[model samples]
Structures are given as C-alpha cells and as structure tokens.
Target: MIKLLTSADAMLYREIRLEALAAHPEAYSSTLAREQGKPLAWFEERLTTSDVFGAYCAQELVGVAGFRRVDGAKTEHKAVLWGIYVRPQARKSGTGRRLADAVAAHAATRVEQLQLAVVSENEAALRLYAAVGFVEYGREVKALKQDGRYYDEILMALHFGGQGS
Candidate 1:
C-alpha cells in the first residue's frame, strides 16, 4: 500500500532515508552522514513542507518517494521526483514502481511536468522510470562524486500535455 506520509512518520522516514543514502551512496545527492546527524524534527519539517509518500508491507514502511515543486514563478509548473528508495527485502516486489507512479500521478495533478535524475548505470531504475513515461532529455557528466569517484546522471521528465506538451 502507498500513502502520503505525515510528520508522525518522521522516525520511519529518517530510518529509511539513512538506509538509502548508505546502501547506494551515489544514487542520492544527500550524504548519509548528513541525514544521519539530523534531528527528528528536521524530518518532521520535511514532511510538512514536501509531498512525500511511503509504501507499506504488513504496516511496515518499506519504501518512500517525494515530490517537490521548484520555488519560482517560472518553475511553478515543474516538480522534481526525489528520495526514491526501497528496502532490499522490498526489491522485485514492484514497490519502487508503485511509489514512483504514486508520486508522479499526484504531481501531475499540480505540475505541467515531473522531473527526476537517476545515476546512469542504475539500469533497473532507468527502466522503471521509462516505463512510467519519463523520457531522458539530458545527461550530466560526472554529476555526482562520492569517495573520489564520479557518477553520471540522466535527467528525465514526464510532460503533461494539457499544459506543456
């Protein structure tokens, strides 16, 4: 099941977020160390400010994804897909796709386009986004560096035609 997370889920959110940053350090822009040191209130504040969703299994939060609109008049029609992650046990269970779709569907209701960046070599994630109608429009060279190693990211977006086809 998938549902928008609330401030009450902050602890669960922090736990999973730290897991994401640690398991795949190159996949997210935020460092594990950075988030790990943050207080629960920070995560609670994030829930109040962002559109974050969580996937559950047997009432346990197994995955999470977020949608945040760019702050500016010119960028009001766009939102970014961020903090997409699923536990190892949750992999291959269609949890990621479900979470991504939930965020995109909810975002489409308000934005003209939903954008995301994924590390180029993450084939499963690439395929999952493509399946949801997000097409790559650009790629950044060595966009992210971790432990002195660089990783490229493919920039993708799904356009909502009624507003900006």
Candidate 2:
C-alpha cells in the first residue's frame, strides 16, 4: 500500500530516509552525516510541510517519495519531486512505480509541471521517470560532490496541461 505520510509516521520515515542515505549516498543531495544527528521532530516537521508518500508491504515501510510545491507566486505552477527511494528487497516489485504515480497524480492537481533531478548514471531511475512521462530538459554538471568525486544530474519535468494552469 502507498499513502501520504503523516507526522505520526515520522520515526519510520526517518529510519527509511537514513537507510536510503546510507545505502545509496550517490543518489541523494543530502548526506547521512548531516541528517544522522537530526531529531525526530525534524522528520515530523517535514511530513507536515511536504507531500511525502510512503510505500508499505504488509506492515513494513519499504519505500518513500516526496513532492513540494515551489514557494514563490511566480513559481507556484511548479513542484519538485524528491527523495525517491525503495528498499533493495522491494525493488522490481512495482513499489517505485506506484509511489511515482501517486506523486504525479497528486501534483497534476496542484501544479502545471512536476520536476525532478536524477543522477546521470542512474539508469534505472532515469527509465522510471521516463516511463512516468518526464522528459529531460537540461543537465547540471557537478550537481553533487561526494568523497572527492563530482556527479552530474539530469533535470526532467512532466507538464500537465489544463489541469492546474
């Protein structure tokens, strides 16, 4: 099952987030070193402020994806998708697709475009986003640096016309 997470699920959310950061440091902008010390309240605040969706198997939280609308009036028609992660055991089971669909469906109602960034070397993620109708618009060189190495990112966006214009 996939659903929008609430503040009550903060602890679980933090656990999965830290797991993602640790398991795939190259895929995210945030470092585990920076987030490891954050309190549960920080996760709760995130849940309250953003649209984060959690994927569950039976009772275990196995995946997560988040969407946030741009703040400025001029950018209110756009929203960014972030933090898409699924446990290794949960991969190839459609969990990621379901989470992506949920976020896109929700975003289509609130924004004219949904955007996201994926590491250039992450082929699986690029394919996933492409399957969801996101097209590459540009690339950012050295978008993230970790352990003395720099990584590029592909910026992708899906335009939803006539829905939230």
> Pick by TM-score: which candidate is best?
1
Q: Candidate 2: which stretches are off by over 4 Å? A: 162-165
Model 1 Cα displacement at 151 (Å)? 0.4
Candidate 1 whole-model C-alpha lDDT, 0 to 1? 0.95
- Clash pairs detected, candidate 2: none
TM-score between candidate 1 and the true structure: 0.98
* Candidate 1 per-residue C-alpha lDDT over 1-165 given as tens digits, one digit per residue, 9 for 90 to 100: 999999999999999999899999999999988889999999999999998999999999999999999899888889999989999999999999999999989987998999999999999999999999999999999999999999999999999866448
List per-candidate RMSD values in Å.
0.8, 1.5
